[model samples]
Target: MKIVIISPLWERTPPRKYGGTERIVYALTEGLVKEGHDVTLFATGDSVTSAKLMSVYPRSLYTDGVSWSNAYWPSINISKAIEYSRKIKADIIHSHSQYYGYVFSPLSPIPMLHTHHGTLKSQSIGKEKQATLDYFKKANYISISRSQREPMPYLNWVGNVYNGIDVDSFYFNARKGQYLLWMGRFTPKKGSKEAIIIANKTKRKLILAGKIEKNNRNDYNFYKKEIKPLIDNKNICYVGEVSQGKKVQLYKNALCLLNTIKWDEPFGLIPMEANACGTPVISFAEGALNETIKNGHNGFLIKPNNLNGMIKSLKDIDKIDRLTCRKWVEDKFSVSRMVTDYIKVYQKFVKK
Candidate 1:
């Protein structure tokens, strides 16, 4: 099958730092290529992948500090991705971006697949409801989680294929370090501040690793006022955006990964990635965490915002074995499985 993957313009495919969608695009593109399929990645020039690269931007709009104004549509790269898809005569175009695919899908030369990544709010849907309905009527939608699909219950949902990672790349020596881990954006929705509170109450060393979206001023202020003031403790370390190598190392060395999300996350990838590295995730039982992590099995999923429950679970992290943790990921969240699921979706539409 000739597949063209349209990556999000906010970050490069296989992002250098933090980008769930970009990372998933990279995994899918590589997984398909490894399966002997013709895969083309329509992403920024900075993306590095085995698939044929069809760059729409000179560099990543996020990494290069380029605004939407810098591009032809001011900062959007959707036009370039759509143009590339048409040029390649893609048998199927799989889009990892959000509403941008709506504009291209209506006139697509072939079947198109759009995977909704973010937790869409009512306001966001209201802004693009007509366009989204029109696009989904002609194209297939892949929801990252079942919970996400409920918002637009009327859309043609092809299936739910959870985002996965290359487990081998995340292999880290679990005994290298002794500290709790928090890896995700510094936004309030992610509950980074709550992670800090739990770490403080537990008297455990907390290593915070993630990027702060400078554009969200309120989030920045919350970090500065709430999270930063507590950073005075020697046990708390705020390591900025981590590289691929650092990410694996952080997950491997840590005793466990902490995810205290407040919202219904579409699909949280950090927990799965941490599990791959032989680290159990101690997360709140909100959103996909409940579906991904089994309480007292691979990891612990406690009540949302329960700092005491989180601290208690963090203490029991030793019960989870490295081999069992790795096995859990293989059984449920391998990139191969993700690829096969998507291939099935593509076959359904393309064969028709």
Candidate 2:
């Protein structure tokens, strides 16, 4: 089947540093191509993919230091994708862009599937809420997790497909190294501050690695007031946004990954990545972490915002077998499995 994947303009496919959505899109595109399907990736010019790549922008908006007000790019990108789909008589157009798919789905003659990568509560606010209600029925939506769909149960959802990763790329280390890990955006919702608290409480060496874009004042302020003060370099080390190689090393070596997210994260890739590395994750029971972390099996899932729970889980982290963590991802979150599941979704809408 011929498939076109629409990626966000902010980052390249399989972003060098920090981009969850783009990474998932890259994995999905590669997986489909590996399975002998003809795939075309609609992304930034710099995006690297095995499939044919179509782009409107020279590079990622953020990477090129482009201003955020240049919002016309998304429309242009979507238009290009729509035109390409019609020209090629594509079997399906799978969109990872949050809003564009819904906006243009009705205009397209071919079947379109959109993977909802974010929380509905955040997206469905004022005018966006009305727009969603208006155009939701025209598009087929796929949730990243069952928990993500709870906020908008009324939407026309096809199914839930969990985000997946390339397990082979992530090397597994059965023998874990010293120090804990906290990797994500340096934001309040991500609970970087809480990770510091947990690290201090448990007296474990914690390595914090993630991006803090220059435009995000709130993240900068949060880093200064909440995270920076506590960094001792020995206990809590702040390693700014890491490359894929560094990320693999961190995950493979860390004792466990701390996912102290305070918000309803749509779907976290870090936890699954950690699992792929034979590393366990200690996450709060919020959003998709509930499904991602298997208590006492691969990792422990504590109650949200419960510091004591985090402290206690750390004590029992040794009980989690490293091989179990690796096996869990192999069984459930491999890229091959994700591709097979998505192919089933595509076959449902493809013309026989």
Candidate 3:
């Protein structure tokens, strides 16, 4: 099958650091290519991929300090991908650009598959409501988790393929390090501030690795106001955004990954990546974490914002065997499995 993957423009496919959607796009594109399918990845020019590469920008928008909320660049990215797919008479145009990409699906010359990589909130009755999804109902949609579809279950639901990672490449360590890990973008909904409180309460050394996008005023001010003062290099170390190799090292050594997310995020790659590195995750039982985390198995799940539970769980973090964590990810969230599942979704479209 010939497929064109429309990647999020904010970061390069398989991002240099701290990106999830593009990383999955890279994995999917590579997996399909390995399966002997013709794949065209529409991403930044800098994106390195085995598939045929197409791009609207020379480099990732975020690396150039472009704000994620700016829809202009992404629309251009989507247009380029759609136009190319039409020209090539592609079998499927797989989009990972959330709502922005789907809005342009009406112009698609072939079957379009859209995967939701980010969470959606209510927009009264317009933006994220049924009307919005209804506009692009012709496109087949895939959800990363069952819970992620709750906000708009009425959309043309097809399959729920969990986002996956390459488990074999991740470094696994049984001898855990002394510190805890908190990795993600600095946003109020991500609960980075809450992770700090949990680390402090548990008296564990904390390492925070993620980016603070200067273009996003609210997030930049949030880091300054809530996350900055809390980071004391000695106790709460802020290592900033980490490369893939550095992230694997951090994940393998950390006692556990702290994911105190406050929102019902669509899906998070952090927990799966952490588990693949043989490190457990202690996260709030919200969104896909409910399905990802198994208490007393790989990691413990605490009620959202429950400081005491999170602190207590952090103390018992060692009880969870590191091997079990790695095994869980290898079994359920492998990239091979994700590719197979996606093939099934695409086959359905092909039969039509």
Who is ahead in TM-score, 1 or 3?
3
Tell me each candidate's RMSD, in Å, in order.
2.6, 1.7, 1.7
Q: What is the lDDT of residue 256 in candidate 1?
A: 86
For residues 257-313, write the lDDT of model 1, one tens digit per residue. Answer: 888888877889999998888888888887677778888888998888788888887
lDDT of 2 by residue, 32-141 (tens): 99999999999999999999999999788987777555658877898889899999999999998867668888888888899989877744345655466456655799
71-95, model 3: which lDDT tens digit per residue? 9988988888888888888888899
> Against the true structure, what is each candidate's TM-score?
0.91, 0.96, 0.96
lDDT score of model 1? Answer: 0.80
